[model samples]
Target: MDPARASIDLATKIANAVSTVSAQPWEILTERNPDGGRTFEAADIARLQQIRSEYATLSMRGNVFCFREAFDYPGFSINEYCRDLHPNPVGESINLKIQAWSESHGIWIPGISEHCHDIAAFLHPEAGEDRFIAVAKCLSVDWYLNDSIGREWAPTMSPAGQANAMALREHIVEISRAMKVAPDAPLIDKACVEMLLEMQALSGHPTWFSRFLEMWIGHVQRSCGNINAENLGQVPDVFTYLQNSPHQSGLYYTLAHFEFSRDEYLDWSTLTEYCLASDVRNLCWLCALIGGLSNDLISFEKEFVTHQSQSNFVVVLMLNYPALTLGEVVEAIMMILRDLMEHFVTLSGALKNRCAGRHGTPAFRATGIFVQAVEWGIMTTWVWQTRSQRYQHARSIFRETQQG
Candidate 1:
């Protein structure tokens, strides 16, 4: 056989083998549901159903700082970090506004805007009322976008599937021209295009806008690839998994949102250099790694319960380290997270000191904000993953296992 054909043959075999093995568990965990139904303990059903209400309460607890105490920067108050930002009456009004906007656009998400109050508040409390509205809109829109993209275009081995995938990819490319071309496409694509266009409008330079657009494009492709791989039951090795970390964790899009916090344009070279700096780059990688790993650990049981061959990092780790028990794999991931959190604090202070020295320079200010945003992303993600009803099954089933 030709080498290319031979390689393809091997890949297919590996995927088939993985799919077969994934269906049969070497170790038992959660109780599987019959008739291909969702695997839920009776109690878990109430938890999942009440997720929307549960989240509303959690949202009211407001934003809490995780690692802000380790560093201080001027113009950015330490007290600001310590202070709890309780949303005012305007927050409800903003939610209603966004909800109505989404409904008008044919993308209303029931309970999503209400539940994400804390998410928007946690991520961008620094924003003024109007900016917070924008952030809220983006978050609401994101829920719809993820559903449409993932549910509609997740890879399948069919002619129609290939066509849908290509169309979704092209939609991203043509999103900027969506208004001019097709005003009545799915609300998700239109909303996504509007959000990106708003970001581009706020970003004076095309370079940053272009960079963000590319990031979104890459995110869709990488995420869809993982979904496709999961469909095929192909598990990636650690390195390949880690390489997908940034995209999977949404680090780039998180940074793009942070960019809006800076009004001044950072030239390509300056931003690149700061991004490439030892502490900055390493801290980012660590954040992405921690986020990805933590998500896998949290969501593992959900996959098991659903009988979905999710390409979770813990499963990938198990594949590589065959002797490790499920408990051991959980522990290893937790240890890695603890270590990364420590490293994040240490690097945050070091980077803050360096930025303090160059405080007068634009680069330093930009770098400081970038680091702060990254810290927020990591810590906030932990809170969301742990508390969100989205992972109710994971928490109910695996929480004790993780603790042990």
Candidate 2:
């Protein structure tokens, strides 16, 4: 669901919860708590809600990062995202704010009492579909991540809940695979297409599956998504799904985790999350290779993730500076080609060993997400680099090029 509708629904749900309990006069507990300086005036709430709305509409950083992370898809980095989102001055720090927010609201969560709070706690009872979709969107997004603020969020689940979770996971996988096999649109009646073949089985009412499927596929094709490369059918609706897809893939986490702690590589053991993402990065590259697309960016990014480059990066200058002598191109080309070949070998081994067996096609299917995130980063750097040799000049040239 979009953000404004989602927020409205969330507000309603919280309000409803309050109203419901207040029917018997639910008490608003007045504990001796310190006031948080981050005041939420009516204006603040309006701005915040609008911010949420824009996130939904634009499929901004949160939507991209969260969604990509959820399905083991390759993802975008929030550090880089912060620089792009432009939501706050000085590129706001999410973890810092989360830490502050957590400290202030930690007590509000039910732990000692055994009844942890949910969004519904503060929501109105009469939540609308859109608002619930918004709140549920966050929950669903967060549900994919095992923790938020480094605290576990696996709310106590009854046997049924566990079953449902497993079932939904399987359902999504199956549906995604079926969609993969679907022929190019216009081959059959467009109305027969199901956005999610698995979920379609459950849409009992007059199904919107056809519309969803048609739009989603069209969206991917138009967006140059590597996921549907085999089909390349046009559908405009799929863009909607990008809003809630996981955001960070291995690159994002690697960069962000490193940002939060420079010793991320040394502490790689602690990087338990985004394991699938690490695998997905390689998988995405594999998909592009599988399709035999000779795009330099994908080929290079896959290589970077596989092995460290040993060659000097000045080779980039040779390619663009055509006025340079052949000696320069040859010398640099020799170095660049060697690195490329080595990277390719490393990539093949990485994917085949680290992912080819356990991760295979499903990971490949999620490549669209991986490509999307990388494209965003790539396009950003691409535009910036053309403007000036700002951040990536002295860097391996491949550092930004590798992921972009």
Candidate 3:
């Protein structure tokens, strides 16, 4: 009857359920891209070297964590579909700026700079030169603003911080209006404003643009609300914690980024209707849940060591179930992740079957691409977390427990 034993028992049940599901979806989803080949120009390689040099210099100046050599998570490995999608010179340069800005603003996480390049390049691999550059800029700005400012700052904002946050929110609203009304309008020299301008020029659908803005605004509002919720001091249960975790994970923004790819292939109405479909919506949420939970698992040690354990999923579980040891909780989380992955695989197949009738239609194509995007999101997140220096210290515990 002990809580820890009960959790282990539940995890056993989930694992048994997982054993019956076909893992073909996992194989299909994680398969490498057939066109993953690339031939970078000499200039591209040189630019990458320069970015590496800059990162090395930055690393030297601080006590940065070293990247982990490996993480042992069974059945979850790096998704190589975007392995060749390294950032171009423009993206690399903007990522440097993003790192500098975050450090200046006191929001820099040691390895976050690495994300700017990989995520942007992965999400926009097929984009043309201009659109890819625009996407890189927007993604860089969004990363810092949403993760650094919205997540890190808003939760603990003092009155002055709140004032500054308010100013930033208003500025975003102003830029959104400008983007809508005068797509060619000139903005200030700020990176954030320039990103808005770039998005305005490239946004394939007005609905996508509006929805992205709405999500951004909602992030700000929800984050600000946390400041009054005593910085998420305690939650009644995992369900309550999960309600907010997905948003904070920034997975929705990633979904919006995926929409950029759909712009070229699907009409606005089709895209809109597809996004509204129950299966599509469920897939998106599952992506969020998987990504967020995996993040909490990987980052638990770092957060705990840094005293930022208040809002983490592991911390929430620890608070609720005092009888559970850290290892037990981690094991339970792994089991839950497996269950979620099985469910995603099942739903993915069902959705594909539904689209089978319209094989060559835009809806069908969109469905294929969307499912692939979700798979990429989940796997890429795991890959990044395991390889990133941000969570390097957790690797020791992960290996000791052997439950990652």
Candidate 4:
């Protein structure tokens, strides 16, 4: 009757339930084409390289503008943010992986290197240059802080590193509050602070920006805790794992970024009620689960081999269903993903029907746009996962780590 034992029992029950369901091969449910169904054309190779170069330039600018003096680690350089922080035995940079994935998926835009711009332009072609640049910077800093810095340093963080992270958390809260009041205020020395100000200035609704900041804060906090749990070798039960996976998956920020990108269509004052409504929350949560679970499914082998499975759903399932093979657990996850997608489609239709009479209103239009963005995100993520070298090289990296 101890707490850990109870969790294990609950997880076993859940895993048994999952094993009862038959899973089909994963297929795309949304009709929307990823990158407009464009494959990498031979003639486009040069242009794609040029686009990657531009993003590298932007990344360098981000490192200098945002991270230069942000963390107090000895010998810390902002240049580190510009490099691939993820373990890569192939020596390919993160930017290179992004470029390759984007190009092959045909998501590559000639002038727009950032995915935010692609979503924004898809929703509103009239979205201007300044807004594009601002969103790009927002994404850059978000990646630098969470993916690059947090992933690289959190696991083995010394007392000094923990202090640095805590300081950043405090600074982010202060700046988020300050930006809500004076969005155009002078830039703070911190990269995240400046990006928030830009996003707030361009955001369609005050509440949306506030919600976005809140989600980001939660993500940072949850990521730290999850990493600590992993360090301690504590495997959470299925329910607890589900509760935390979505936040750590970074899908909350993805949803927020989608909203931020289509700011011109949103009228937060009119949409505020809907934003708080359960239907809308359900839509967002479903999107996050789909994304988070798909990531866990694809990265399962990597994490399992690396012994970093403490935070992975697949790992939790394996622990509960000790007799189940990895292949069986994967199929179970796929089944769960398919069910979530079906639910999303049904709920999205209902939500759209609820707004049928107000088609011309900002709220109605925004709802439609938001639903489309969610569909796009889901399809794009699945397609990218299938083709991305980022997830494909995990075994090679693990082997190299062992050899070293």
Give candidates' CA RMSD values in order: 13.2, 26.8, 13.6, 17.7
User: Which wins on lDDT, candidate 3 or candidate 4?
Assistant: 3
On residues 1-404, what C-alpha lDDT tens digit does candidate 2 reach at each position? 44344434433432343233223310111111111112223443343234334324432221121111111212433234324421112112332332233334331222211111122211212333332222222222222222211111112344465444445334433443365434543211111223133334433334334433433332222221121111112111111111111111112221121111111111122212435444433332322221111122222222211221101112122222324332232233333233323333344345345433443344432233233333333223223322222212221223332122
Worst 10-residue lDDT window, candidate 2:
25-34
Q: Indicate which candidate wins on TM-score.
A: 1
Q: Sort the candidates on lDDT, descending order.
A: 3, 1, 4, 2
Q: How far is 276's C-alpha from truth in model 4 (Å)?
A: 11
Using lDDT as the measure, the top candidate is: 3
Q: Compared to the true structure, candidate 3 yields what TM-score?
A: 0.66
Compared with the true structure, what per-residue lDDT tens digits does model 1 show for residues 130-195? 556666666666555444444223433365665675577567656644433366677667777677
lDDT, model 2: 0.27
Across 185-238, the per-residue lDDT of candidate 4 in tens digits comes to 423224566667777788767487777776766666555422533344444555
Query: What TM-score would every model get versus the actual structure?
Result: 0.67, 0.19, 0.66, 0.59
Provide the clashing-pair count of each candidate structure. 0, 37, 0, 0
Order of candidate numbers by TM-score, starting with the best: 1, 3, 4, 2
Clashing pairs in 3: none
lDDT of 1 at 213: 66
TM-score of predicted structure 4: 0.59
- For model 3 the local lDDT of residue 15 reads 50
C-alpha-based local distance difference test score of model 4: 0.51
